[model samples]
Target: MGRAGRKTVLFDEDKPHNRVTQESHGFITQDGVKPSDFKKRARTDVQKYPSVSIKEKRVEIIEKSGGVFRIQTKEGKELYGSM
Candidate 1:
């Protein structure tokens, strides 16, 4: 979406992967890659876009009203967006 000039925010809770030590397969060019390494590379690629942002917050609730989305985080931050 960011590549299409749309503003996007990804919320991450920083949770550990259940199979962190195992290699991930099925992804082209990323087969056999570790989860942490894949995430690092993917984040780097996404961050290159100015309209994209990554938020290190866990979402508590998501409510939609009047075609708008309201996202509430566990840290008491609220964000609004529309599709």
Candidate 2:
């Protein structure tokens, strides 16, 4: 979305897949980077774009209609987006 100059919202909850698991490997310049650090760097990069925003809440449901997507969060907030 950043590449296309479109505003974007990223939902991250740090689920099980993001739990501490030592070091992450197999990326070109980021091999052996700590998982937490890697995630921080990724978030930082995304934040570099003023059009990008991050949401730390878990999504409860997502529905698509009329070429738009409506997402509901566990906190009872709803978000809508269209491509």
Q: Pairs clashing in candidate 2?
A: none
Whole-model lDDT for model 2 versus the true structure? Answer: 0.88
List, residue by residue over 1-83, the lDDT tens digit for candidate 2: 97577989999987848466787888779877888889989998998898888999899999999999999999999999999
Residue 2 accuracy (lDDT) in model 2: 72
Using TM-score as the measure, the top candidate is 1
58: Cα error in model 2, Å: 1.1
The window of 10 residues in a row where model 2 has the poorest summed lDDT is 14-23
lDDT value, residue 6 of candidate 1: 98
> lDDT (CA) for every model shown?
0.90, 0.88
> TM-score for model 2?
0.83
User: Candidate 2 at 79: error in angstroms?
Assistant: 0.6
